[model samples]
Target: MKIRKNTLLIMMILLTVTFMFANTKNVSAKVTFNKTSKSITKGKNYTIKISGVKSKNIKKVKLKYNKKIIKVKKLRKNKYRITGKKKGKTTLKATVKYLLFDYTPAVKTIKCKINVKNKAAKKKKTNNKKNNDSEENIKPEIDWGENNIDKLIAQIEQSKTYKGTLYKLNDYTVFNKGEDGGEDQYGLITSPFYSTIDWYSKKDYDKIMNEVKRIVKESKITDDMIDEEKAYRIGRYMVKHIDYDYSVYGQRIYETLFDKKTVCAGYSVTYALICRYIGIDCDFVHTSGFYIDGQNMNHAWNYIKLGDYYYVVDLTDAYCGQKYDITGPFFRESGYVDSKQMSYIDEKYKTSDYTKDHKVDNISHYMRCKKNGDMSQTLTDSELYNLPE
Candidate 1:
């Protein structure tokens, strides 16, 4: 009986030692993050994988982020994946639990740092601040091209597709080799073809020229008017007379003059046409502007040369459905009557690509075609013939 008791004590000691060793070795797993840190752009995705989870009895692996729970997807035998969901600095822990032989569970955790960058968001914020500052700090200038005057005159002369004015001024005509002889034709010598005339029928073309003549005659605009005065008078007349048309569609010039209902295009084109007829240098300036719908659409306006400097003339905004003495001292206070015309326009059209109205001391920037944008949005047959219903 004594021997048996000694043997029993030895067996109990050995069993206890074995149990402790087994407990210490309960499903040991090595966890490592595929990446310690990662950067991702906003609205983009980044994934991290954890490997070396050697425990076969692993019940599950979990990843927590942004106050949300994520069940790690098993990539293979002992690998897991965690996808990031938010921007900024983030820390995540891979928690793994597994059952031991005795059915008891053990937990192991490993941590990793992740940084996500939202460059797009940051850029937008910076751009807004810069745009506000640019209005005053930046000066606006137009390239006007290598042959600005000749190009402008040619555009105007070629615009007479229906043939009211064979020549607005003698300078508008260039010698071209015709079947008869080298005849003086409209447009530049380099580009003599009437490329924009296909859209107008004889009647429509006649109406366009006749309307231009009518505006000149009615406004009493003559060669006696200086360029600066002519530009201002035209702006004032269009704003006071032309009603802002929100619904009028199709022919812009016709609707502007005949119906007295037109949008920016009508206002701008009418201004350009009148300017060209009266010998004031002007052109249509097109730009991409945010509309009431919060979308960027192609918008139209005008730029005119006044003395040695150029100015932006936005008639659509100037009218404001009221008449004011454009020549009064009140109008002359800011060197531009537009400050009295509409304040909203003063803000909306202040982009560096548009105008530099805040710094009225400097000449305004021309809303010229930047890169891929078209330099001209003339109501040519190529652009206007196919209406978008």
Candidate 2:
């Protein structure tokens, strides 16, 4: 009986130990990048590694980067070499996928900031004392936070060297009213218009603005209209009024507001300004997409925020009836979503959601059947504007 009791006690102890062992969690391998951040010369190769990961345990290591801008090469086991071909800041991510051994598959990731500097440009900057002296007088450029956009627009309009491009406005006080410390690209001035003409003078600027206001007044756009309603009316107005042609003053503010014959730049700029006039936060989106002839070209458009979602307005494409049927910013083909225009949604404006639910069916057929189609259905006050019922 004593022997039986001893055996039973030993069995109970063994069972308790087995239960605890079965419930124990698997230990994870500590993975870390060799360096948290790095700055390297452009066109030079640099080594990056995941220190704590075992080569045998790793199924494979993958490096994610902008292939167009940066290049990566895998060297020995658990090591990678990265080279930035362009002068900019890009994030390098190394994902170490582990091989499951008596446990669920676990993965580890390490990220390192890679800043590629142009060595020659830096040296030139150091040598240029005149530029440094003048920079103190020059105000800094900003990405956002200027409350008076109308005043900024007026200032840009009045500049004799406006250069149709937003480049000059990047440094002006009214435009860059705030500080930006995010990335180099966060400092660039962006606009939907592509013309490179000068702003002319205050007389021309006032005339153009007065004409714009007259059109808005004629269209009867008021504060009572929601953002979507305002945008729809403005887009429709541009399509009806503006012709796809060049003017003597060029395809820009003067041509768009006065002559009524302008290209994508004029159409997009007019739409953006009209929306802004009616208290809608709208901006220009520069994109590259297929033109009417199936040829890829740089296009200009506008993006507006309605309710909580953001949608794109390609007035040029819509006016030509090329992209009038697509639901959002993408074209639908064979039940799949395809990007029609590559907009500035990457780390610049944070408009990535421009591609979500952006598909509509029978685009080519619809456009072929109905040239210069009426897109009143697509830009309805209820559907596009999200009016409160």
Candidate 3:
């Protein structure tokens, strides 16, 4: 009896130790900066990269530092370029809010100390910030072959299969076209002819473009129709023909054309394509962080510029109507518009109501293509298309 009691006490001690070890979980995550300290000449740029966070997981990245010591800008998800502005010392505090386990959002911050030296401040310092923004110096790692913003926007505008791909894509750095010509990490280009699916997708691309024109003709969209009427008709026609298929390549235009189904990206790409054939001013605006049906994710939508203000035309959100019943920000109305009454992109965004807003940091996108999303909604002229004031 004495021996058994001693053995039992030992076993209990060992079990308690094991449980304590198991409880040591990394809740905040291990955030690290490449350089803990650095010294650089004024006007020279120093790169500081953060580790322990993936690009997709990053919700929002912010830098806290004195602007007088350096001018910093985000080079990518994990990197920052800091140019010394004057002879001084400052610390770069980078805070990153990222999703944990791809579900829960968490934040962590790391700091880097820096010392700047040189007579760089001798030049007129009053307009340095403006000058830095206005000037474009091509760098090797993230090169935009074209430096002029206006010219680049014009060039891309002319290249879309339709006008709103611009709105759907909206300056997501991939559109910035670094030296590799807009290739993303997934080895895919924004266009079928660009890369990834290049040669094999040509026929598919041709098929979709031809189909877009045919669909417009079938809709009886006359040249005399106002832009709003034409857009409403074409948008409804797109929703009627295509069902929502949440899958890989759902963001690509050709995929939606061939499959007759796609996620929000596919809708944006197709809508942009159709608008191109019909002659309309449109583009795509995307957010890395968004919410749909109670889940946080990324989303894309169509935007149109009408005079002084920008209007939205999210056909994807319209999937909420009498057809696709996904129960997202998409209302029963023909398309997405906020209370501001511009147009419906995502009514949940830019609204005064925080009750439904799921904005976590800056992360806005879908975690997965909703596999079971259904669609039967169509514009059918029953919905109203309110043009921008």
Candidate 4:
């Protein structure tokens, strides 16, 4: 009886150990980059494969390269693959969570070094050699029409202006007074624009412009598209790429082009510049509005001429509530303004006169104007008169 009892106890211990091992081994997975032994060139694409154990019911297999999520693909029941573009020392890790148990988690990690060599870098080096060899065979041609005219205009505009003083204007004061001094008014100044243009040489500017042109051309984007869908798309794109920095009160269109940092004015000016570059008639309009938090302030936005009517767009306003507090001065309070209230301004002044003072209560008044078949009465003469001088 004692022997039988001891035997039973040993069997129970063995079973417990086996169960623990099974959970630890089978519940976890691993992935490794094959070329982990050496540094690879930058910009070279490489694949890392994950293997060992069943990943059939895995919830997520996140492959991170220097903390950035690389593209992960499932190969089979227990295999996965990851592709990465950046070249540097990257640590790859695999995380698998069992779907059946929400709390149960498994993780396996491996460190790998990737040195990606850019093919374009090598090609550029070779091209420079070839250009040197054929130096006498090529003649430099000056593009006086477009290049010179643009440079001269930029120089003149930049030379004549200063980084105009920016003062925070009270919404109520501007709303009732009909005009804030131009110096204190919110607008993109010529100096900053010129400075931005000068910051990028003709070559660099051409490259950026060409990049935009390529995107437009390759996508087969047209003027009609710009007038309709493209404008909004550009707005969204700018908002996504450019971030608002409250530290910098304002940014010029050129700065936004090069530095890619901007505030509301930057978004509107950049939009207008790109539109004009693409032969679309667009204009910058100044408006004052408090963002959702109700801190009434001066602001700027844009108007895009599409067909016979002008469409109002405030990229800043559209991006206000996202990723940041809309109540902050950097993000104006105007995003809450409804479309009906927006329609109160005359089409010409929609971009400029739509101020923060016009609350939701004004919607009915604007709607009445639209219903009366009198576009003239849409905006009060006083509203237009109060716009920035």
Against the true structure, candidate 1 reaches a TM-score of 0.36
Choose 1 or 2, whichever is better by TM-score.
2
Give candidate 1's error at residue 220 in angstroms. Answer: 1.5
Clashing pairs in 1: none
The segments of candidate 3 whose C-alpha lies over 4 angstroms from its true place after superposition are: 1-201, 247-249, 289-296, 324-389
For 1-389, candidate 1 gives per-residue lDDT tens digits of 99999999999999999986676464444445666666655443344555444336667777665543222344433344444345567677767776556666767786777665644532332434435442223322212232223334434422222332232222212222223343333231100122211123335545765666566556544342345544565666676677876677842565678888788777776677677656665555444434547754445566565433455666665664334223221112124434323333323345674344223324222222222254222112222222121
Query: Across residues 3-118, which tens digit of lDDT does each residue of candidate 4 receive?
Result: 99999999999999998767666545333334344444442224444444334545565545553424444443334334445544555554544332324455556455544444
Point out where model 1 deviates above 4 Å. 1-199, 289-298, 321-389
TM-score of each: 0.36, 0.38, 0.35, 0.33
Candidate 3 residue-wise lDDT, 137-236, digit = tens: 2111322232222234333422222222221122221222223354322112332222122122323434654566577767656443445556666776
| Model 2 stretches with alpha carbons more than 4 Å out | 1-200, 246-249, 288-296, 322-340, 343-389
lDDT of each: 0.49, 0.53, 0.53, 0.44
Q: In candidate 4, residue 137 scores what lDDT?
A: 33
Q: List the residue pairs that clash in candidate 2.
A: none
